[model samples]
Target: MTQTAKQAGHILIVDDNTDILIAAKLLLKKYYQKVHTTDNPFDIEEIVKTQPIDVILLDMNFSQDAISGKEGFYWLKKVVEQDPSIAVLLMTAYGDIQLAVDAIKAGAADFVAKPWQNDQLLGAVAAAYAHAQDKQKVGQLTRQTQGLNQALNQGAGGKNFDFLGQSAAMQQVFSTIEKAALTDANILITGESGTGKELAAHAIHQASLRRENALISLDMGAIADNLFESELFGHKKGAFTDAKADKVGRFELANEGSLFLDELGNLPLSQQTTLLAALQNRQVTPVGGNKAIDVNIRLICATNDNLQQAVDEGRFRQDLLYRINTIEIRLPPLRERSEDIPLLVNYYLEHFCHKYKRTLSVSDTDLQTLSAYAWPGNVRELAHAIERAVILSEGELLDISTVVGQVTTTAQPSQADSAQSESDQLVNADTFNLEELEHRTVRAALKHYQGNVSQAAKALGLTRGAMYRRLEKYDL
Candidate 1:
């Protein structure tokens, strides 16, 4: 690497001889941005705590005629204990093969002999700095992965869903996602609602070179326009009324990994301008901060809306579309891939059966019934149907009677028709208990929509959370 390229690294030299310390710092400072030196080993801890030192060069002997390398071993342990990611190189004039092996075994990064050639010393320091950087990246990636996993589990209720398909249309999607994962180019996934767009994003991330790092996914449709900049670029403490503390934005959190932005077409023209600038510059400035932070993330965006139509209609920016869609992956809706329905149904059935602790088997007739239905909610709808069936059906052979309903309506019907139908169905009820009435209503809604939660919630004038609560409260 060029000296300018290595300017971000910091080096520390610890030696008993002032001459050695000065010479080393003078030569290294020209290449590295920061160079520290101290003769007393006692000051190592304080320097380490205060400065972001990437590599340390230490002398094995601290006293005259001292060559056993015991002092070097002691400080090496101390430095590593303080920060395991920092690389430490041990040096001694009386070095031997045994001492080198011992130093390495004691956590020293490398061994250097005293009176080393200038080129040799520089190469050692450079190698040590690179090692430190790798360790730092690994450590940061681990912490970010843990945080992202926790966030996903909490937000998605720990749903474990994967893309499963064998039809022609789906094979094409799989091919495109695989090709996209081989590069760092930005990707745009387009499909109808509930067509597993997010699942495609996850597949790309898992297959990509950045798989070891966290894949940060955000729903662009859920972000309010006013909070768009603060959410994507972050904000400092006291930046605004609700800015309680310094927050890292999604872009920063996804550095050196992948950032999946769902519902990109829902982004307004005004906010598109800000997002465009960040992607173009590869950096983001916090709301109240002047310095911009550089980020390296593979961009993956999904949208059900027609971005091309939106751009032509003057809703989306043409330049932003060009920036995001270096590669476009269009997922076929469930209806277009009906041949894969049986496979999806069986997978979900097995999963939900295991989850709900039931021994059940689906009949060929039931599978055929499911395969024929027009699933407006796609695979998500199919999975929910199977889960509900597993929970509600009794006595073996998978009762899908509750999963089949009349002509599927994408939206809620008029209030008159809904109330009249509900009343007629309730006219034969045996009890007047409010709880019992609510349970029956929830069950009917689920049945009417074939286990589609969003539609059922809308039909009952309840949020999805309320619908879920009813399902759990009555164990239906």
Candidate 2:
């Protein structure tokens, strides 16, 4: 392996003896990429902040009659205070092992005695660098916690982030969210379109350890295949023709936060590999930059498509799927939780009524009609229906037909006469399961359209994606 790939870390050695600093720099340079020497401890904080130094080697006794290591302890305290993530390693004589131990207890990560073995010094430095990496992650998390507290306390749009559902299925989903929020694990939210997958993802982020950070959401479906990398990992100035300046990618912007990957199944196969690599490495190099900056983010991905089926079809990478699907929360569609329809209707009714400055309410009889119908578009459609109804309502009692017309008029097949005829035929014919009737309807639509997916999807009142998924489920 190349030196750059084989070894990593920036080492800084600070000591009173210039020779010791030079010697330590020479020894550690072979094992690490960057090494710098300094004879002054007063500039320790400046050096640490100015440079991305992973480990620092410090001397216990600086000036004459400093054998007690008082100055060293003071410097160590300063270094630790400046950035505890930078592992501080003390260098002392064999007789000062006691002082070194005291320094270690005071926050120094490790210590190496003078006249150390080549192997011993290298091992200590390597271990210290490892510790620095872990501490860096902890530091990020700590900052995120502080920021989250501020946001929640300040009421930063927390009220608008409405997540309401109390059915058994929804309760289970909420339970999963609570359990998974505090950890660094990746989450995959699966549901049909309009089932509030994105809302659930936001809820998890709000509840997570990374909640203080902004939840950076990327709609993989909306992003073009060619611009995928530049969108996620970013590019440096002049990296490409349109590259204007150094732009921070979503990953960087979401540092110490949560990253929500919406419509994750729509991401192309090629970008899937790149995404998997970044998640595995926990680092990214800009398009024109060589140094990989470490990132700490909680990943929450949502998809309406079946990722496992996509993997089987070679449309998605199985490894990438596995990485993001550490904790899968499958959200049930609105049809399964019919009990929540009245509650949802009232909630949206009040929200839209307040916004539109209209006093409106849905009658129980009209709500029953809404609850009885199958909401193919789920809660999102229900919300729209209420909003449109509230806007159109001329009286306090909502016009139920006006509210129901949105879905029925926009999605139903144009052949209204034939649909009515078929409904009458079904009513007069033998009893049939609703699921079977739905399957037959979809299959008949496809046949009528001569297997044209676009026409079939339109006629069947489904998005191409949802129709395509149902087709696979029924092997049609």
Over the stretch 1-476, how does candidate 1's per-residue lDDT look in tens digits?
34555468778899989999999998899889889999998998878766778899999888844868888988999998877889999998886999999999998889999888888888888889889988977865664565566556657522258788999999998988888898999999987656788888889989999998878888786676778888788776667999996666788789988998987877878899999999989988878654466789999998867788888999899999999999999888676787899899888888898999998999897887788766655676677778888988999978887765553424444435544566667778889998878877876676555444556777999864576577657544
Model 2: lDDT equals 0.76
Assess the local accuracy of residue 31 in candidate 1 as a C-alpha lDDT between 0 and 100.
87
Can you give the TM-score per candidate against the true fold?
0.60, 0.60
Prediction 2 TM-score vs. true: 0.60
Cα lDDT, all candidates? 0.80, 0.76
Show where candidate 2 strays beyond 4 Å.
1-161, 406-476
Error of 1 at 434 (Å): 17
Candidate 1: C-alpha RMSD to true structure equals: 9.0
Q: Report each candidate's C-alpha RMSD, comma-separated, in the order given.
A: 9.0, 12.1
